[model samples]
Target: MSAFVAEPTTALEIESIGNGTGLWLPPEVRDEVERVQSGTSAAELTAGVVELRNLIGGSADLFHAAMLALMCGTMVEHGAEPGAAIDATLDLLVATLNTLAEDPDEMARAASRLSIPAAMTMLARSKETRKRWRARPEIMDRLEALEDADLAPFWLREVFTLHDDAPLLVLDPNNRRAFEFRLIGVRDRLYHCYALLQDALLRHTGPGYLGAEPVDPLAVRYARNDHLTPADYRAATTLGDHQRFAFAYPGIAFMPGSGTPAELPTVDGVPLLTVSPKTIHFNWRPANMYGVIHEALGSSIDLIRELSPADAEALLSRCALP
Candidate 1:
């Protein structure tokens, strides 16, 4: 006996003669993808996503269905190897869903595992900020305690008055550290970040983009907490401009600005428009997705780019989508 169940055919379902143990799709999803890709209007894409969420309605299968539909739908549009990408993404989703079904605690456990590196990266990104953060012994204590406990993603709101659980990234109209604040909004942005990352790896920066020099995948790790100093923050602009790359943290993604060394300017660099943070000055879209690829694989693109085909496959195998 199979676990597959069939619901009445909606615009999304195709006529099936018998049971197929795979994901189901809603019609609106494919419609919106085609619309958006055809330049019908990017806003239509949001409507499609909304429909998927509506369908989710708290069921795991529905959630997987929506994700699968979106993953395959989007990959078909931009992927270099759509079939392989779809299979990989679907497998990851199925494995995760199975874990969730068996143990609901798994999501939190996974989130906890991701929390330390993410928290450390945020704390270490800028010198002035790091000093302020370090002076707060209470905050430091919490981070230290995280070594023994799973990282509670919501804990960020305690230290930063700016943090919130809002799904979309919002800039503080009054705060100067607005960009930094957006990074803490991982409550709703985390999974979306993963989705965007998957899309980029399969379509934009994968094997097709391999360069003459093979890159090492292991070189990508969480930015070291004690490594970045005031000097690094000052010189960061030069570094960012020289490479023209963006960096992805837990919930936020940003581009390096070109300007005075002391004053590091930033632009929104996340590829997905829905989750992109809006500063008072501008809204960002997917100008470059390579940074996300770097963040997702927990390795730098330069390093991954340097690997031969076989080595690259081996490196990608090590990536943990969870």
Candidate 2:
């Protein structure tokens, strides 16, 4: 479904999401839009985009991030928000993103749908930020203004980016650049149900947050080598203000950050919280689930030997998975 009318119920995450302090705005977009839009007449700007589109022979995803952003801006001007397109889709995207097994690139189409909604949220934030800047002249110099006084900058900045080497945008108006990172969707939003597990994993680490080592032998076998050891993401902030979204990965539905969903799969003695990452994504093996075993077993993780055989079985059981 493109966007849902009935919203699914979900439990709340424990600690509210945290963010690294920085400008939410992506600068490349801001600069390029400012360059093209300023000085150049509006007609010239549209002509340039049309020229660029003709030059770029192909685009992988169904939509263009820049155009989608522009469309969002246009909608705002008409006094409407993307509405359910955002509210319903955003929740589904976030949950899908949390899965352990999903293709990032395949998620492109779904991710593209989120552009307008996400843009609206950003526009609202931008307006408040701008309001503050106007009220206090002392801080105006420190602020980064995307557009002169219009809402277009908030949406178009990321689309009309200038980076030649950045892997994310994949926007090659001229066909000279080599392909790099091929995201299923725009960097900020979830593309498919599997939007950002690795992204979800990156956040839910460190002492209390907890990440597993794919300790299950079957799980270890299926996991990609790249994911086993966490990479030091120089730019973890790509999700932008969306970072506040709870546990954006798949497999484990109930994170300490996000509490348990009301409906769970087969529970022999306890609540099934974790799903076998390998099985769910592949859809070939027996659907296996783990109970809220980590806490039930008395400690975080001491040893498998310590648990009785029956207790272990109860900890992990076959069940329906998302």
RMSD of 2: 24.0
- Per-residue alpha-carbon lDDT of model 1 for 47-162, expressed as tens digits? 43333333332334433333434433443333222232233333333343343434545332342232223333333222233334332544434434443443333333223222
Q: Pick the candidate with the highest lDDT.
A: 1
The TM-score between candidate 2 and the true structure equals 0.17
* TM values, all candidates: 0.22, 0.17
Tell me how far the alpha carbon of residue 96 in candidate 2 is from the true structure, in angstroms, after superposition.
17
Worst 10 residues of 1 by lDDT: 294-303
